[model samples]
Target: MTAAEHLLAAKSFAELRGSYSGALFIIASGPSTKAFPLQRYADYPMLALNGSICCLAEAGIAPLFYLCDDSSFVRNRLPLLLQALAHAQHLALSPRVVGSLLAQEPQALDGRSAYRFERVNRLPEGGEAMSDRRFARQARKDPDFECDFSWFRQKPNRIGFSRNLDKGYFSSRTIPYAGIQLAYHLGFSRVFLVGVDLDSSLGRFYEQGEQAVKSRLDGDYEDYILPCFRLMAERVINPGFQVYNLSANSRLPAEVVPKIDLDQLDALLAAS
Candidate 1:
């Protein structure tokens, strides 16, 4: 199937809203994920982010949904992306990634349930607040340049977790933010984050030496990631919507997201 054909068959975010009522585990590419026992959680749904799909693929388990918000990863790691497509039952791709696949490898999205999502600002009121001249200059130099620091620190609620993904998902220069929004939209009240270590220097568990993709997490932390998650915790984490961090060594403080061991996770699942 062509990319267009796959997109035509893809389900909208609205269609998935409140469609599920179970716990969800969001798998990231952090090194801590290597220790995660996929066998124990095989019965539950999992969302694989970027190269983390390889972990599930290796374990012979298909991800309930595969999400890739980075266009560069799509372009530089076509083989891995194709592997993800093969292992994922459904895909949630950012507009930029879709454009990259449409340009370079439309056939990669073939024979899969795929959906496209927009990357919007943290708040609905103000979009990316870049000046026209600056936007034009950046656009002229780099097609992928989309960052602007104009209104990043304007408010405490700068980071948004979209309840309605049809509008878009807030981007924090990290995939987990989008994953969180996707989980919420899918009606997963209990969200478990697996392998979101958030330390750029440590690198990803799936990549080694030259195969590693450069991480922007460290640089984006102060301005984007920290504030984003902080607001997310304050506004989103509640009895109705609980988020737990499975990575014990994660750089994110337990205050923002409570850390849980495997036994605790099992207990929570059993109780739920």
Candidate 2:
């Protein structure tokens, strides 16, 4: 599908409010997300990433939706995710990663009611009618013995999720792009990020499940994550809608308020 078609297919505020009307809960899959008192949030609709999905599942907190690119982290925790599918409202994913989730199907969600399994993009030409089993079977024939989908990258901004070559403003900035898209669709004036710890220890997302991944690019934090986020913050965040990082490990400077917590946000929301 085209970019417009992809964006149009995304859930909109009207449909969401018609169903779940409340704060647009942004659940980052960072290890620290496991720290939140999730039971306190049983009533809110949440969008969780891969590891956070695992943590959320273990905590008995059913998220409204799960989001993740085709990173290895996502692949490592498939069983946990497939388990949550039985309860989650939807599983929002990029196109490239669909293979991983599809391959695990048949068993991943057997006997469970059908939940929304949305692929961010349309299936490629000739990929139509390709059921989960058929796709997996084809992968079995690959000579390279590699059929994983963790290499899936988000499509360029406003260009849809399948066009791999077009780089819009937010193509490289995964977090903010998704946040903005979700905020617009959820009708939120502010997007608060909980557990957005970009610190990569061991070049992964957890330390014994509590650690962070490290980067060798000496200032990769600045060179990579920051520039992309800054660009997205400038181009995407609307005047009425703002994005704030609300994690204990958030490295965003004070210029970005609630950079540490929701104390101030709670007060503001309460007053409003």
Candidate 3:
């Protein structure tokens, strides 16, 4: 029930990478996400990250790809995800969401549709874990600190952490760099980012018609949503792989990705 407990359960990625191969895009639910024709890319080995499942459904997009874990804001959107899951081959979600999902819908996962559940251990301080003492201590001394998490507790069904991930950066806990971490762990040589526009100029990232609940964490966690991507670029970019931002409007760090116009994505895919 603790945020750390949920996040730790979400850390695994090996099982998710087992079958899929090819470029996997980490899709977010930013407004720009609606500008692109996502349905066309359904067959292009995609991965919908968190709240993206809703935007994809709105765009009439089907998930040949799976969904990656991100936040509890999206985690609460489980019913919509269940509907989206029927269209995807696999579903990799944060352990918090997974626990909630299992509790809410005993039979939410249907193995018949080529779908298997992959668990994600959330980066502490990124989810509802901000209430955690460890995270609180870090933020207390560092005024500019961002990211939120809950208390830590051992949990089952979490993705095991790798040595590279356990570096004592801020604290014993971690943050929301999962989009990049999970993407790389999935063996994506090239990444196409959609809707990952973390800036508010694009629009509220978590829109469930419940603006009040979203507003509470949005202000404090801005550091987690966008900065983590920059952090991810520093940590995950490698010789064999690179990331590109494919949004109509984006403000990701230059190191994160080379921004691409939607038209370019369409034309490039059409040509291919």
Candidate 4:
């Protein structure tokens, strides 16, 4: 069966929608995340992306959800990935990853780690094309222009082209974008992003020290990162949903999503 058919066949998949509410913290594997005050936000639900699990594990912070779409993650870091999966209540991953895991360990997906396999369609719908056109127009006016994304207020059936995950809930350029979409689908109104540095040069915090992995920040900002945030700003934030960036050294522009300091989190949580 196809991935979509497999998803449709799974009884738990539909029920997984909107399974979580209230505030959410997304932890990406950036170098700056090492300094985040994890003790402050320890109580909130967190979604760990990629190798961030290693750092969170070291800090004794168990994430509620773990999301990884890249098959390379499984190939290069299967042990770490499985260890995270064993702890996470839910896992959003590609079907290929699931297959690979089950092959190595037969009991990997035996209802132990709630698995939600990804389904995607590469072709763009008309609405996505329009968002792309609109973004392009705005970019032509100003190179660093950030789209108002008010169009998302109308609840466009689709959000954007290029890097947006609206079409099939497929991963765009980064795993965190997919994590953001999953958070929204899980009914989270307030989302806080931690460790999303978006800078490739600094490398990942988890990979630091003697055995460091090479940075994957070679992609162009306009072609990869900005489009994903633009979609989130439109589809997720413009409609009154909140997303805050907590990475102090993050390369994401403030106009895309406002950044909040770790010290300010107490006030932010109380206000929520």
TM-score of each: 0.85, 0.62, 0.61, 0.76
* Model 3 stretches with alpha carbons more than 4 Å out: 1-21, 55-61, 68-76, 110-177, 201-222, 225-227, 263-272
How close is each model in CA RMSD to the real structure? 6.7, 11.1, 8.8, 7.2
lDDT of 1 by residue, 68-166 (tens): 978899778887788887889988987567768778875676666887766643222234554434443443343222223332444333345567677
Off by over 4 Å in 4: 1-13, 122-167, 209-211
- Give the runs in model 2 whose Cα sits over 4 Å from its true position: 1-22, 107-177, 202-224, 256-260
Cα distance off (Å), candidate 1, residue 207: 0.9
Arranged by lDDT, best first? 1, 4, 3, 2
Off by over 4 Å in 1: 1-10, 121-158
Question: What's the lDDT for residue 27 in model 1?
Answer: 93
Q: Which lDDT values do the candidates have, in the order given?
A: 0.79, 0.49, 0.51, 0.66
Per-model tally of clashing residue pairs: 0, 11, 13, 0
Q: Quick one: how many clashes does candidate 4 have?
A: 0
Count of clashing pairs, candidate 2: 11
lDDT (Cα, 0-100) at 34 in candidate 4: 81
- Return whichever of 1 and 2 wins on lDDT: 1
- Which candidate achieves the best TM-score against the true structure? 1
By TM-score, the candidates rank as 1, 4, 2, 3
For candidate 3, write residues 1-272 as lDDT tens digits: 33334444443433455344456667766777766677767667666655566766676666555554434644556656676666555565545555566566655653423222222222445445433455444543442232333356421112122212221122112222344454555666667777756555435454635452333234534434444454445544666666778864565555456787767666545643
Q: Give the per-residue lDDT of model 4 (tens digit) for 19-51.
A: 667899999988778888776678888998878
